[model samples]
Target: MRRQTQECKEYMEAGEKYLDCQDRQLTSVMQDWPKDINHLLLARNKIQVLRDNMFSQFTQLKSLDLQQNDISMVEDGAFSGLSQLTTLLLQHNRLKTASEEVLLPLPRLTYLRLYDNPWSCQCSLDSLVRSLQLPSNRNLGNYAKCAEPLLVVGQKLKKLSVDSLCRDDNQVDRGTGGGDGGRPRLPLIKVKPEATSMCHTYVFPKLLLDCSNKDLDHIPSDLPSDIVKMDLSSNIVKHLRPKQFLLSKDLKLLNLSGNSLRHIDTAAFAGLLYLRELDLSNNSLHYFQYGVLEDLYFLRKLSLGNNPWVCDYNIHYLIYWLKHHPGVSYTGLMCSEPQEFRGWRVEDYVKTYNGECPKDRQTGGMDTGQGGQGGSDNEAQEVAGETGEQLPRPLREKKRNRFEIIRLS
Candidate 1:
C-alpha cells in the first residue's frame, strides 16, 4: 500500500486493487488514481457538481463510495465508462433530482444507495420513478422518498401515485413568445389567498391542483375548469354521485386512494372523458356497478388494490372488461371474499368461473360476459344470468403468501 501526502491519503490494499481517500477534505477527485483500482472511497469530501465523464478513467472500478458529500448536481453522462461498477453509494447528499440518463450507463449495477437526499417530486423525475419500478430495482422502493411538494413530503417515492409525478406536456404552455411578435403583455391574474387555503394550485404556465391528505369530505367546488391534474387521496370521500366531476372536464388524472368510498354511482365519472389515470385503492368498495367504468375509454392505468372486493357473480363484469382491454395496466385486483375465490387474482377468477354465475342466485337479467366478442353493447347489458350448471375448473396455482398491495389507509 502506498500513502500519499498528509492532507489527502491514498492507500492500496489486496495487491494494489483498492483505494481509500475518505475524510480527506478534498474538493475534487484525484486525477492520478491508479487505473487498476477496483474500489474507491471518496466520502466526506467537498465535491459539489459531478461533471460529465468525471470517472471515465476509472474503467476498472467496481465499487465507488461518494456518500456524505455535498454533491447536488450530477451532469448527464457523469458516470460514463464505469461499466464494471456494481455498487454505488450516494446517500446523504444534496441531490434534489436524478434523471434516467444519469444512471442508465451502469448496466452492471446491482446495489444502489440513494437515501437521505432531498428529492423534488415533479414531471422531471417521472422517468427515474418508472425505471425504479422494474423488477430488478424492487429492493430500492423503501430507500426512495419525496422531500418536496409538502403534500407528500415524507412519503416513499415508489409508493407515490404515477399521476402525481406525470404532468401533461401540452397542458402547460412554457414558451414566453406570443402570436403578436414582441407585443406588450397583459397584467397577470393574481391567485387569491382563499384558493391557496383550500388547495395548492399553480396557475402560471398551467394549472395543477393538489388537495391530498387534507381530510376533505368532498371534492373542492371552486377549482378552475382547466386544471389538468388533481390529487384527492387520503381523505374522507364516501360516495361519488352522478356528474361529480362535470366541472373538471379537462382533468387527465385523478387520485382517490385511501378514501372511504363505499359506493360510486353509475355516472360518477361521466364528464371526465379525457382522464388517463385513476387510483381507487385502499377503499371500502365491495363492488363497482356493471358499467361504472365504461365511460373511461381513454384510461390507460388504474389501481384497484387493497380493497375488500367481493368476488361473486357481480365481479364477472370487471373480469370480462379486464380480459378484453389488454392495453390497460392494473395492479392488486385480487379477491378478498367468497371463501372459494379468496386471494385469487381477478383475471384468474374470471377464467375459473368462466363467466358463469352461481345457479342458486339471480343476476337481475344482467350479462355476465359483457366483453365477449360477437356480443353488442346492448346485448351485453341485456343478457340474463348463466344457467345453473357445474362450476368451471378451480385455480390450481399456488396462492400468494403475501399481497403486494400498498396499504395507504
Candidate 2:
C-alpha cells in the first residue's frame, strides 16, 4: 500500500491511519474522520466545547491530541466509545470543571494532559479528582493544574486536599426554625475552624488547597492535618525549616516554584514519606543535599528547572539521584557556572566528570578548602572559584573527601 495525504481543510495520511486537522479553525470534531484512523491531531483550533458521543465512531483510535483549543465544556458521554484510546492531550483549554462521567469511560487511557484549564475548585469536581487519584490514573496528576477561583490560580489540581473542597459543606445550614413575626428563617451554620484559620479555598471536597501566589513568607502553620496537596509557588519564602512542614506528613504534592528559596535544611522534608511530586523550580538554589530527598521513597516527579545551579562537583549528589530515578522529570536543568562546563546539562556533565575530583583539589583526605567550610562530615565539595553565586549556608555544611558516585548494587 502506498502512503497518501488527503487535503480538505483537514488532511489525512492514508495507509498510516493518521489524521492531522490542527490549526484549521475547527469549531467541532469533524465527522468525516476516516473510520480506519488510529491517531488524530486536532490541536490549535477553535473547538469551544465537546458534545456527547462526539468520538463514538472512533473505537479504534489510540491517540487523540486536542491541545491549545478553546474547549470549555465536555458533555457526559463525550468520550464514551474510545475504549482503545491510550493518550488524550487537552492542555491549554477553557474547561472549568471535569466530572467523572466525562472521564471514567476511557478505561484504557494511560496518559492524559489537562493542564492550562480554568478549573473551578468546588465539590462538583470532587468525583473527577477522586477518579484521578486511583493508582491506574495517577500519572494524570502531573497535568491537573488549576487556573481559577483566585486563590489556587496556577496550582496543580492533584495537590489539593479533599478537605479544601468539601469544607464548604460544613457551612450549609440544615436547621429548620421559625423567625420573629411568623417568618421562617434559614439556619445559620458556622464555618469550620480549620477553614477559617487559613487563607485557602477548596478545589475538591477537602482534598486540595490552592495557596499559590499568596505572598506567604512561610508555610501556613494552621493548615489542615489531613491535607494532601499544597501549592506554595510564587511566594517570597527564602528558607525551609525542618519544623515548617512537620505536621504535613500526608502531603503528596508540593509546589514551591518561583520563590526566593536559597536554603533548605536537610530535615526540611523529613516526614514527607508520601510525597510524589515536588516543584522547586525558578529559585536561587545552587546545591541541594540529597539527604533532604532521601526519605521520599515514593517520589516520582521532581522539577528543579530554571534555578541557577552551580553544576560543580558538588552537584554530583543531585545528578546521581536523577540517574537512579528514571521516572523523575528534571526538565529545564542546565548549568549556569564553571566556565568550562557552563551551558551543559547537569546530567551530561556528570557523565564527563565520571566521579573524579579535579586534579588540583585535595581528594585523599578531608581538606577544609574554600567550599568545604561548615559542611557535614560526609559531603563532597568542589570549588568553582566564585563562578555564579556562593552555595547556601545549609548546603555548605556537608564535606566529603572523595566523589562517591552512586553505583547500583
Candidate 3:
C-alpha cells in the first residue's frame, strides 16, 4: 500500500486539485484521499468490480478517468454522490454489461466514454442501450460495439435498435424484416469533418482551442459553441465568409493574426456580440468595409499591426467606428497607401477629409495661399494637437505641394 501511494501523484494545477493514480495496479480506490479534489484519475489499474458507494466521498469531483481497467461489474450505487461529475472514462475495460441505473448519481455528466468494451447484446442490456441511444446522450457511449450474439457482433451500441436487445414481441413494433424484433432501422449519422481531431483541446482553465499553424485555407466547420478562446493564427485563410463565426457565440478572445486574410464580409462576425479581444495583425488586409464590424458591440481591444492599410476614403469607416467606440483600445493603423500619405497615421489621414481651415486671426479671412497650404497647415496642426507635438516646417511644406499640379508653359 505504501508503494502504491508513493506511485500516485497528487498536485494542484491552475488552482484546481487533481489526484493521478493511474498505472498503480489499484484494485479499488484507497481510503486515504482528499475529499476536495476536482479531478481523479485511476486508469490502467487492475480494478475488477465496483462496490456500492465506491466513490461517495469525492462529492466535488468533476472528472473521473477509469479507462484500461479490468472493471467488469459496477454496483448500482457505485457513483452515488458524484453530483458534480461531468466527465467519466470507462473505455478499454473488460466489461460485458452495465446498467443505466449505475449513472443515476452523475446528474451533471456530459462526456462519457464507453467504447472498446465487450458489450453483451441481450435482454439484460436493453435499458442501458436505450439510455445511451437517446438524442440528448449523443456524446455518451460513442464507438462502443456489441461483442456477443454472433448475429449482431461488432455492431455499434449507439446505432443498435433497442428492439433487437429484448425478446418480447409486444415491446416493439415489427418492421418488414423477419427473425429479430424487426424494428425500423435508423439511418447512420453522417460524419462531418471537425477540427477537434487535428487540434488540441483543453477543458479546464477556460475551454481553449488551439488550431494555429495548421496550414488551413479556410475556417474549420462546426466549431464548439462553448469555447471561450480560439487561436487560428499563422495560417493561409484569405477570406472571411459571411456568418463564419455564427456558431461560437460564447467566444471572448479570437486570434487571427499572421494569416493571409485580405477580405472580410460584412456579416462575417455576425454572432460575435461578446468578443472582448481580437488580433488581426500581420495579415494582408487593406481596409474594412462598411458594417463589417457591426456586431462587435462589446469589443475591448483590437490589433491591426503589420497590414497594408490603404489611407483612402474606404479606410474612413474603420476610424469612424473606432471614434464612436471610445472604449476600444487599438494599435497599429498606419497608412501604406497612395505615396503622398504613406506612413501617415490613419487617424491623421481621416482628419484631413473635410479640407476646411479656420479663419485667420489677423486678416479675418481663409488663408488659401500656395496650393491649399492653408488646409495643409490645418492638417499638420490637428495632427500635432492629437499627438501633443509640433510639426516640422519642412514636412508641412512637403505636404502642401503634394496635390499641386504644375502646368508646362
Best by lDDT: 3
lDDT of 2: 0.70
Q: Write model 3 residue lDDT over 221-292, tens digit each, in one string.
A: 757677899999999999999997998999999999999999999999999999999999999999998999
Candidate 1 local accuracy as lDDT?
A: 0.72
Number of colliding residue pairs in each model: 0, 26, 0
Please write out the lDDT profile of model 1 over residues 199-280, one tens digit for every residue: 5443222346677888888765545466688888999999998887887888998999999999999899888889999999
RMSD of each: 19.4, 14.7, 10.5
Off by over 4 Å in 3: 1-35, 40-59, 64-83, 88-105, 110-192, 357-409
Model 2, residue 68: displacement in angstroms?
0.4
Q: What is the Å distance of residue 246 in model 2 from its true position?
A: 24
> In candidate 3, which residue pairs clash?
none
